[model samples]
Target: MKKILHAGNNLKGKQANPTYISFLGPKLEAVGFTLYYTSQKQNKVLRLIDMLLSVYKYRAKVDLVLIDTYSTSNFYYAFLVAELCNLLKTPYITILHGGNLPKRLDKSTWKSKRLFKHSKLNIAPSKYIMHEFKKRAYSNIKFIPNALNIEKYEVTERGCERLKLLWVRSLTPIYNPDMALEVVRLLQNEGLDVSLTMVGPDPHNKFEELKETINNKKLRIEYKGKLKQEEWYKLSENHNIFINTSNFDNMPITLIEAMALGLPLVSTNVGGIPYLIEDGKEGLLCNKDDALTMVNCIKKIHKNPDLRQSLIVNARSKAESFSWQNVKALWISALA
Candidate 1:
């Protein structure tokens, strides 16, 4: 069995959504790969130090290092870790996670090359990211969509008489949680009976802003801060529609989970989302921050039961392709 050191945010118990390492690490272990992980420290500087120390400590024992690469400040973590891996003559693979990474590649060309070019392989979770990298002449990359246990997400029967929207993402500016609020407000203004439930952590303290908007607009919105996967899966049963209002996104696992649970999707068509869901096929798509378009999309599903059922069926079918049973083999092969 190959020994792998997975490096990324492992803050499962820290009231944050489980990152890629939290999910993929266990899957790798179950398939006979021994796995070690890094820094659960919430502080940025401390987390970087802990990650570097883990790499140094496991340098001799592990056959490979798996770095969860992102586009923001965490990008520096991957760069420094990869640099250390290079110095130590250890092979490392970068698992790309940020939806805005294409912009990073353009903005930090030299750093991107230094970090990605030297890796054993770069794993892209979406074709959107893969295409971006290939366009920049980065050939040592592969596409592996994020995976989940499809069987765990039981499909729920839904009704359209009263629209219930479900939004799951961190309350961050980039995700544009405000757009979800605006979408709900617009639907209510149209004399439509709509209620929204948001589930996520407020690392940047954006929940207060969301609350103020909800109160001022007098909208029916429930803010369920940071729920466990199963907790929100149960809450999803009450919701008929899933709204993804992110300005930028990669292959979000929540969208797949919503699909598996039989919720019709209405998402902003940005980054890899269109690649994930075909417009008027598996789900409906609108431009970023355009709440009116999203409202119209929801209205279409409300008026047409056939369209809703079709989207639910098609989306669930697409989500099955992302199940761990199907995707584990790809990871096994790639690691080999």
Candidate 2:
């Protein structure tokens, strides 16, 4: 049996760690491949040493290595992973998950261009990301949409009294949690009995700032810090509107989960949002950083029953195309 090393840092006992790293393990193992994953901290000083140690440890066993892309185009890890793979004479693939990499590259003073130049293969989750990399004429790139299995959400109304808006992302700067806070404030200011549940753990770095934003704005937000994926999905079913405040995102699983739950979507038009949404169709996209526009989009769905019903129908249908069974075939083809 062929052995593969899953080279990515992990957060101790965190879902995102196992969840993201376990992607290729099952599928590859089904085909008689042995997958070994070792999680390491992302600290630069120690990270390089840990990676070299991993390469040395796995050198004699694994046939191939798949490196997880560091979040938001941190160029540092990408370079290290690629260069390490080269030094060890091992073949590797880098899955680029940062949807806002294009913006960072455009604004970056760092040497992303130079570091990524030696990358073997770049696996992008959406065309939006691929488009950004392709614009720079990067080769050896493939578009692999986020693999999602269709979820079963029992359609039922949780109470029609107050409009429930759900935000299921980390309270991080990249996600622009303040936009969510501001939108909720706008809803309450308009005398709307809207309730918001912000689900997801603090990325540690931005939790304090996020709390300050909520306290400063005096918004009506319930910080339900980090929910299990299943719980969050179940919660999404009870919610009416799903909002994504990410200023930089490719295809977010949150939006897909919302669609599967038959909840209408109102997201900012940034990163690869356009790839997942057909404005006024499956979902609505607002100009990035425009809390008023985001609020207006949600209010539009809240007020018009027919519009909400149509969008729910359309969004659910669009989401079907991204099911794990369906998307895996695309990934297989890309690997071919």
Candidate 3:
């Protein structure tokens, strides 16, 4: 089997919720690749240290170093590791996962070029990132959709009565968790009986603030602090509509999972979301930061049976295309 070194924030025991590496590592292993990960450490400095040491240790043993490249400070982790891989004359590939990556490149062109220009290839999980890269004249790009085992997600008859809404994402400002509550508030103010459940980990202490906001408003919103994939899916049974209130985003796995489970999607048309979901087709897309519009879309889906059924059918079809069974060949070919 070919050995692959995956350098990312592999916070297995430490994280409140699992990262994408947790999902991808196993799939790669099942397809005949031995995977190694770095930085399960809680400290950022230690994580960087672990990543550098991992590359050095696996330099001769591994076929390629797979770096989980981000647009934030995590970009430096990729930069340092990629620089080391270049010095060792080892080929490495970057899996681009940042929604704000283009801005990172534009802000620091020199560093971005040094990293992208040196890597063997850059894997974009969405066409949005691919289009952004192409605009910057960055070649060596590969389009690979993020994969999930479809069997794990169960589809149910999803005609919602009380407007049971669900929002799942990290409790961060960028994701705009507050807007989810606002949407729920608007629905209730209009005398619609709606309930919301927010499921995610709190890395930036945003959950406590959100909890306070929920209490102050005295809304029927439940804050589920960080659930495992199975736990969230089970909770999703009570919900029919999935709300994504992100001010910015990429191809969110939560949205895809919601689509797979036959939940009608109401998301902001930002970043890679438009690429994943078509407005009024696969799912409903509202303008970013438009809570009133989001509320209207939910009402439209609730009252219109034909529109609701059409969205579910098309969304499931879209979700099926992203299953691991369909995507495994792409990874096998890329690794080969």
TM-score of each: 0.99, 0.88, 0.97
Better of 1 and 3 by lDDT: 1
Q: Number of the top candidate by TM-score?
A: 1
lDDT of 2 by residue, 1-336 (tens): 667777766545443423456555677566566787755665555765676678778988877677777445345666676677778787777777777677666765355664455655778888888888889877778887776667554444544457898988877677888788889888888999887888886756565676786778776677777787778877776678889999788787778878877888899988788988989998888998999999899888888888888888998887788777777665555544
- Candidate 2 Cα errors over 4 Å, as ranges: 14-19, 40-48, 71-74, 103-117, 151-161, 205-218
> What total of clashing residue pairs does each candidate reach?
0, 2, 0
C-alpha RMSD values across all candidates: 0.8, 2.8, 1.2
What pairs collide in candidate 3?
none
lDDT of 1 by residue, 233-262 (tens): 999999899999999998898898999999
TM-score (C-alpha) between model 3 and the true structure: 0.97
Q: Which ranges in model 1 have alpha carbons more than 4 Å from their true place?
A: none
Worst 10 residues of 2 by lDDT: 10-19
Positional deviation of residue 176's Cα in model 1 after best superposition, in angstroms: 0.5
How far residue 306's Cα lies from its native spot in candidate 1, in Å, is 0.5
